[model samples]
Target chain A: MTQPLPMPVTLLGYGAATLTTLSFFPQAIKTVRSGDTRGISLRMYLLFTLGITAWGIYGLLTGDGPLIVANALTLVPALVVLERKVQSLRRGDDRLW
Target chain B: MTQPLPMPVTLLGYGAATLTTLSFFPQAIKTVRSGDTRGISLRMYLLFTLGITAWGIYGLLTGDGPLIVANALTLVPALVVLERKVQSLRRGDDRLW
Candidate 1:
């Protein structure tokens, strides 16, 4: 069995992992559904995508299973969001639709 | 100097920390500038806030300096976003402006 992280730590890890990873869902859905990227900042996505990559590295270095898993999973959706945002920008249509 | 994380790991950590930490800037600026929360998600914020709190705890538990610091810093802005989102919901102005 994976040794339980210290109780407090476990709570923190789970919470942190859950929030950071899932926070993008609404934006992702809305972006896709409405095809609107106006509200999203390409700069922010660029930064976020890069940051998540770093976190993934931290996870690997520390062999922190949670960090690795969380970051890895998040990278995909976050990247999608970033890519779409970029596409939206390049298209430069005021109305994303 | 902190022992360099494995070169690759260092790259990952720095990148992750930077991206995750800074990603919110665009939203924060846009949200404030436009006073629009139509695109923001309350549920996502609530979850994100709670998750960040958890990450904070994990940082403390593991004595991981980066995690602790990063999460702590991110929490304030994230909460602000959430609060604004909540307020926006309450106002239900149909026009955030």
Candidate 2:
């Protein structure tokens, strides 16, 4: 069992991870509930989801538990938002329907 | 004089960092150019900006160059988007005007 980071550092890492991962909830919920993505940028979600996937891969390769968990959790709602964004774009609806 | 990761791993880390950081550009650009945030969740940006700031500080404390650079660059556009979101909410306008 190797401790890659000091205890305090590890705590900070977890805190940072939790914050970033949990931050996605509001956007996801809003998108799912309202089905609105007008203000959301298609390119942004496209790139962000891909980036998060890469981060997850990086975590896997490095065997970092927190990174793996954080990125994985974040990916779900991100995908939800991305899916909704695409749907919104497809429908050609500007305002909430 | 410490190499924390192997060359290949370092490359992957850099790639991951580049992706996640660059992902913010589209959202920021869209918000700035369109001045629309109806679909954007204010809570999401608020929490995300704070998280990114924490991540940047964590990088600084950990002496991780890539993390520091990535988070610092990410913080700029993120703040831009966040500020616009706040402004949009304050104005109580739904459509792009």
The best candidate by DockQ is 2
Model 2 bad stretches (over 4 Å): A1-6, A94-97, B1-8, B94-97
Backbone clashes under 3 angstroms, per model? 9, 0
Task: List pairs with backbone clashes in candidate 1.
Answer: A12-B54, A15-B51, A47-B19, A51-B15, A51-B16, A51-B19, A54-B12, A54-B16, A55-B16
Candidate 1 chain B worst ten-residue window by lDDT: B88-97
Each candidate's interface RMSD: 2.3, 1.4
lDDT of 1: 0.72
- Could you tell me the lDDT of residue B31 within candidate 2? 86
Candidate 2 structure quality by residue, lDDT tens digits, B1-97 = 2437678876776777788889889889888888978878878888888888888888887887877888899889989988887787678765332
TM-score versus the correct structure, for each prediction: 0.78, 0.88
Q: Comparing only chain A of model 1 with the true chain A, what is the TM-score?
A: 0.80
The deviation in Å at residue A76 for candidate 2 is 0.4
Interface RMSD of 1: 2.3
- Second chain alone, TM-score for each candidate: 0.83, 0.85
**How much is the TM-score of the A chain of model 2?**
0.85
